[model samples]
Target: MTSRTLPRLLQTPAVLLLLVWMLVPLGMTLFFSFIRYVLNSLRRPEWTSPSIDNWRGWGNYEYVLYSAKDFWFAVQNSLFIVGSVIALTVGLGLAIAVLVNRNFMGRGIARVMLISPFFVMPAVNAVLWINMILDPVLGLNGLAVEGINAIVASLQTMPIFGGFFSLWPEIEPVSFRATQTSAMAVIIMVTWQWTPFAVLIFMTSLQSEDQQQKEAAILDGANAWSQFRNLTLPHLARPIAIVVMIQAIFHLSLYAEIEIVSRGNGNKNLPYLIGEFASNNIGAASATGIMAVVLANIVAIFLLRIIGKSLMD
Candidate 1:
């Protein structure tokens, strides 16, 4: 066989599989979106079956856009969560990567511990953090607050400083399971899990730093901060973009952490919103799913442009 033909033959299975995987479900979703389909409908039994006779003609999209109360909220929340996580992971990852960049005792162990969080299942991370670490009455938050108060109480019995100590306010452990705080908890857990990923990526990038240039900078009286600001940061620009986009993709679809943390009490991202609508309103869910596709594509395009520009060099 010709070399070109051989390559095409070898790629056929993957190309066919990918086409099927992409088209089948998405085609079905499109078909469903244009029809009045539902799991159970007592008032209009015709709506229970998917058929061309019940064509919606953008009715579903309109209903999701205008009628659904949670659609905008979910979009905003999704962007907010993804944005916040990217900001934090990038910042913390840079600092931690710098901290562990130099040789130190037990640096390998520290790196292992830092990276271990990334491997934990999202469900387990949420459960462990919400119930064991952040629980108001049962977790370490409560115990630490109680301990602080006890210390303050003991200090209050001291001679001259007793009055000052007595005036100190008691500490209250934050209950992270409530509506607003539950979202915060989800954010915190997700950040912890993903920051390690940022660290690993940045650290790998750091290993490619120009050491001779760094040495020259030091010789030229460039301080650590100046060196980092001038050289290290510019070197890290591409990797930072890569990390941001990857994290954005992962966090935009965040579901298990949100589900396990607070079950979308007050913090439903787009995916969670789609899941909720899918329970009772398949048409709305499909419309929202299409919106999600568009949102993800926008991000993907922007990221791919950055990556492609860098690749050209």
Candidate 2:
């Protein structure tokens, strides 16, 4: 009946609810990872069911790590895609934030337009970018390339300038859907969608920066780049770290965009690889899921350490 005791008791329900919410699926995933739980088996139909008799100690893990050809590539590609998106988003976000932080005409409108991408459904974003923007043959990419070639052709018709213009080769738009380039497509689209989130966070952080300190730095002959590099950047370190961590965690689970864009192509990340395995091999899929969780946790731990250090300073 003590005050503190009652407060702790009141919080217990919420804590228990959250634990159950997280632990149930996690427990199932772990259990499935260690057993032979395929979706179908014509000869050994019993293998389709989950039973103690189907125990497989470390076989699934071994298979995923050593046997599955796509597992390693998927993991590597996942990390590459997440890292590229984080770099591009943080860089573009910081620049855009700085550009729009100052008062200007239609600033509110511009902010809304930029943020609109973040709110778009992931599926729609994927469709729009792939079909309307990056399709090499029919999209804006091809059109722009064709327009440039036309202008070059016109310039080549000029008698004196013909020789000079003819020396230039014709350009072709790059196809982002192929195996060699699908990862780049995902990175570009995700960056476009997430940069606004970074911009919003950075802009908020910018407002809290000490203007007087900036003015003092200006008086002390610190130039624009110096102010940003020394003053503005240091002030934004925490926000930048937070933005990177959040984006990393989200992008690690990216599935829909990859599914749509890289369907037949050889491009695959952890989530996509898991989906492929899950088509028949439930055990392998669960193992891949566990591995993905471990990878994500390692990244999260590293990022949290960085954020902790930034906050402390």
Off by over 4 Å in 2: 1-13, 302-313
Return the TM-score for each candidate structure: 0.95, 0.93
Q: Write the per-residue lDDT of candidate 2 for residues 1-313, one digit (tens) a residue.
A: 8779988998999999999999998999899999989999998898899887999989999999999888999989999999999999999999999999999999999889989999999999999999999999899998999999999999999989799999999998999988869899998899989999999999999999999999999999999999999999999988888898888889999999999999979899999999999999999999999999998897799787887776866
CA RMSD of all predictions: 1.6, 2.3
Pairs in steric clash, model 1: none
Q: Compared with the true structure, what per-residue lDDT tens digits does model 1 show for residues 170-225?
A: 98999998877877888899899999998999899999999999999999999999
lDDT of each: 0.89, 0.92
Candidate 1 local lDDT, residue 221 = 100
Best by lDDT: 2
- Candidate 2's error at 261, in angstroms? 0.9
Give the best candidate by TM-score. 1
